[model samples]
Target: MTQPPPPPPNQPPGPPPGDPQGGFGAPQDPPPGGFGAPTPPPQQPYGYPQQQPGQPQYGYPQQQPPTQPQYGYPQQPPTQPQYGYPQQQPPGQPPYGYPTQPQYAQTPPPSGGKKLSAQAQIIIAAVVAVALIVGGGIWYASSGGGEEKNDTAGATSGASQGKGGGNGVGGNGKEKAPANPQAKLAFQLPQPKVQDITDVSGSWLTDKAYVKTGVDSIVGYDLDKGAAAWTLALPGQVCGASRHVTADNKTAVLFEATKRVGPRFYQPCTEVGVIDLTAGKLVWSKSVTGGSAGDTKARFSEVTLSGTTVAAGGTDGGAAFDVANGNPRWSPKPNAQDCYDMGYGGGAGLVAARKCGPYDSQYVVIQNLNPLTGAPVSQFKMPPGVKYASIVSTKPLVVAADVGDTAGDGSGISDFFSIDEKTGKLKAKITADADRYAARCRSTEVESCTKVLVGNGRIYVPTEEHEGSSGEYGDETNEIVSFDLATGKPMTGKADAGDKYTLVPLRMDGGNLIAYKIPPYDKGGQVVSIDGGTMQATTLMENPSDDSVRDAENSFGTDYAEILYGNGRMFISDTMLSKPRASSSTKEYLALAFTTH
Candidate 1:
């Protein structure tokens, strides 16, 4: 390198005599402005750092700062945005600039040099990666979206298998299923007869839930052929509950008026008129007593055949009824009783009633009956903190979780109890919960039951974790916790049905539980079948046709739609605006899922 001329021996050399051009890095005394002194004007931005006095200068070219592009680089968006922000646009007709696309020039061959070798290439690659990472972090800090936005949704996938020791029969026969399947849903829902329902609350006799014939009735589509069926109409509008057939398919009972909402409700007392579904004739009309306008009285809501006598519940909490021969059989009184959120076991001699009070206090009353005579033989009773209980036939069993302490946490204390059938006294108590206990049914409710279902080696209760619990913690996930029907312990590895819904009562067939899922009107939905024994799940039907929420007026209770399994054919109710003759007619349909073999 050639040397520049030195400063003469007269004055101090400017910039210590060896500074780069326009350099300001010089040793000097502190200014009067202590720390916040004005920074010296930017020196040669395109120049290298100046050398201090006595330091040798090397023959290096001054590197000019790269010009910022008219457009900049696009940074990757974040995995999840903390705050929603509008994307930036470039200078244009729009107010904000979209992010600029950054550009990098291809490395041109060095003057008179060949391409770099492999080792040199590796070093450059590492440096480039580090720079990109640092740049991405800076961009994320300023712009909010991080670099992981490239992949969204399903960040993790896993498999779940049936665990625990004994895999007893679920509502399905015992069988294990594939986990995390990589297949499509079996099939698509069929677009059936578009029945814009106004009210839909009729049970599925079998696996099918549809109605046929009448304007807004089962008229347009015939369930038998999967098409339109016959329509039957007399005169004024009829309601879904106006008349219903029995599970035996013997008679249809119509709910007469109590007040007029298009159809005048038979009030104070309404008549239970029975019309033979086979003959379609009004066989008999029996009117129960109703309260006078000035009284806060109760009356029958519906009637169910207990044995030969009709067992019924009142609008206000009571069960009483007249037999076929015009005799008052069993009467309902408030306990107030509860069904442990179980089946609407009322109607016959199985009415479970509850009288509830504050501080989790309750008096449960279940009417045990002469299943042969439809008369109450004895009333079963229970006190509060009785976690769960159920009845089979006239014999009732109560399940109370003895797990709570002063701190409200439980030791997972569980026990099963049998109450005397005739006296409602404790008969036998068995322990159910233990470390990793499989027999303890953690449910607060019990659903379907059968004679054989009760006698089987195990009985399954749909259990959920003690929610909002104060004691020992348990998984709050929904599970089918089975207990040995004989000994009462955990029995099987449960399965999740892939959906959550209100715990509704299920109709039972042997060990099989029959239930249906309905569409909420606005969207498509399905009906599912769960095998309690095999632990298998199947979608029997997806009726894109029925919409529950569309007809809000007629839908209130969990029994909004019914699923009953009996001698073969299923009779479903498809109803819409079953009233106000001259105007709009909402409709429903009944379909037979399969022919009776």
Candidate 2:
């Protein structure tokens, strides 16, 4: 009954001897002098029971039921490395197998005893091997094995938390979207009453953005801080919303009101609402009629702004409002039977209107009206058969063409001219090969056409290529021909081109043309910095895949893709509203911004 030495601190007491369960602790390594193969079992002492049939016959002891069955030791094999057991044994080690041997104590061979036969030695050796296996399993289960499994369980729980917590990389990687480095969540959109084909409609100023949530509400989000700056909710249901942002990004007009009519009819909202974006308040909401109700032709109803003048016209004619005070500057007689296209002539310091009497007719009246007084600065009749015309530039020049004319359309070949801003008289006419002049610009009088860029005293137009020619992909054309803005003659010098990439001039950025290179379908696109003074082109940054932009469009119901430049920053987003089916898991909207300065 002498006591054994106690274990070191933090170690559990070993199981009692003859306690049925084997002792629990680190298993002793094999003696340095390896145990020679077993010789034979020692003879039983007098009165010891004879070995029973079908029972263990080797010198091994009888099997003992596990003291703690809850440990489940020996019930299942440990597949992973446990305790100090190597994950995989070195070559020639005993292969892991069933615990065939029984536990037994080591006793020195009986001195001078008869050496056992070969068969007896084999049985004895096998028993010793099984004993080691069973002994190792029992020790692992009792001491810290339960805790190890628990640690594993805890790790699993942690992984689940990371997936659902809405933190960084919140969901399954393959199924989740990567965060956009260029933009952040400015704000969550309010619960939409109706999830229409359109997503959140928005427009951007320098540091702020105007987003139309639902039908009647406009929320201004601060782009720099990624938070809402202000929100204005108009009375009555609103639809067919369109936005016009000021050059300064401080003011905007949301032409979203009046229940929509048929596609061609526009019922202008009772009043147009002009928002002072920086102030986050409505600058003025005044009575107006003939605003668009989703009519493509009735776009005349949409609000238009130029310089400091903000104007909205409809079948009810047109009116100008002071952007500074929102006071009425001038308006035509109400219910006039004409459609007028209003826009800012930034270069001329004026606002002009082109009124078509019968809609898309061959000829229309053009007037360079004083934005402040609403009086004509000059008036002239468009050249006969001029099906499409826009006041693209205000430096006393007029450019007109069908944009794209093929032999079959019978829309006469595209022609351009320069006219006097003061006299509204034709000044000069110049021509380029219709097939080679690939400025297939949009016919809308409001939106700027990519094929024609007016800036830096030169008009940059797309030159064409014959079908199957190398430049057939005009978008991939690097060199663009420029024309003198004043003389209607081709300007000298070839516009610098990108390598195997066509450069399209979007707008004038300082003395450089802020433009983008049209990437091949699905490849991706990039913004280009064109030095207009030298026609030198330098790419700015590669844009995200067209798919990402398309995803934004699908979620937002945007009608067109656009790149907006302001405050030394580039804001690229979808414009207009048209619902396109999208994946349900897509983010609600996407706005990408890049530093341009």
Candidate 3:
């Protein structure tokens, strides 16, 4: 009380007291949004005791719910900047409310009793000990603030860690599933047990695919390294064929030539598993069956060729087998049903689409046959439900899709006809938008007809809307159109559509058009690719419907175009023991190759 001058040990924080001109501390620029607005409750501190009508007072909870004028001095803002931005104000307060920083120039306390100056009373005891350490560091940071969902559930339940203004951290909770660019995404399928492993001659460049695994096995998915490099063990029984899909060198692994169908079973036919991506092995397998599997009127799916001579077509129809030894090398009198109908053909020879009603429905034949015996030598056509063929400008053309009937019940008017594989006739009949991508008839064969998609030269039908043409809204809308490759026609001139997308479980690629979405809990699938000369589509990946979306029709894409994509991976097959049976030339199938990236 009589000797007070012991203050100089460190002295850094100093600024308070009614000093006529001496406080200047830096951080004073606050008042603009600091302690602003809701601060009219101050003068009651002298005696501070007035709470009767509302008994529970100071501990606060009597009806204090209208908050949101916050900023008891900081800590607020955990992620609000979305709507056009600009609305954050709360330090010394006053952004849209005025005021501005470190202000307080209100000095006036030295009139009559003007006191000390040994440094002006040692600067009022260092400004009253720096306003008690700045009001005890603003009451220890507004007592660890509250309310914004218990400080965001205590910073995401990690028990408080992310400090600095607005905690609520991120990542470490494990969220991995976002990237899926896709170049072609393994053909988007899950419904194709075994549609030809190649041997009778669809000869897609050798591996031919399947080596055994109808119920499950003999897999192959390399889309640029996402995994499952190879799985060909054998013996379960479906089929294979992967000769030139792309992304690189292309590989095949076929097997199904055990003909005899009975007497201990054997006409499922086809077996040539070659791998050689650089010498992988299992390169030679040929069993093909004498008549090659054509007697009793015929039944082969496809295996075309003309140079090394392997031409097979079925329903007891197409033939020319001798890729060095499968032997028969000549057939068609059995009426190879016009070559190849429903799907798959272009291995170098067969075009197939023999519906033949309008005087041989545009004829579209393409059969130089005689690879050494298949013998037709010449039979070309192109405008009858064109054979679902692929191979741009290189010349091979055939397409066919129909649905016309004026409704006598044959699902009214729908069409597709492109021919001319070498003169059997009709070169180009691809109707503009072919009346809505047409398909819903009642009679027409190539396996009864309902799908057709050739490549870059253009052709991708799947439509239905003229059964009674319009009105009260209900054409059922199921389109997907395209055409126009060096003149087969229909790229839009009038069924005229672009970027419409929706084929239920549609498929077709030599560029891209995959489909299938919505079934049970969503097997997480959806693809897209449309660059057959910049038609440009591009959706490529959607995956994640779980457990491979119930095998989404065996996961399509032997060549839906852009070639191959990675991860968010795909492959699906179980076609009931390798489906492609004309009475069983060797059938047994199953395929799998999933992964969500």
The prediction achieving the highest lDDT against the true structure is 2
The residue pairs in collision within model 2 are 197-579, 199-556, 268-291, 306-344, 436-464, 557-578
Q: How do the residues 474-564 of candidate 1 rate in per-residue lDDT, one tens digit apiece?
A: 3222333334433233333343333322122133333443333333334333333355555445544333333442243123222222333
Ranking 1 against 3 by lDDT, winner: 3
Against the reference, the lDDT scores of all candidates come to 0.29, 0.40, 0.30
lDDT of 2 by residue, 209-237 (tens): 53434445666656554466777776633
Q: lDDT for model 3, on a 0 to 1 scale?
A: 0.30
- Angstrom error of the Cα, residue 109, model 2: value is 99
Candidate 2 residue 223 C-alpha distance from true site, Å: 3.0
- Sorted on lDDT, best first, the list reads 2, 3, 1
Selected candidate, larger lDDT, 2 vs 3 = 2
Q: Who wins the TM-score comparison?
A: 2
Order by TM-score, highest first: 2, 1, 3
Steric clash count of candidate 1: 71
Candidate 1, residue 294: lDDT: 16
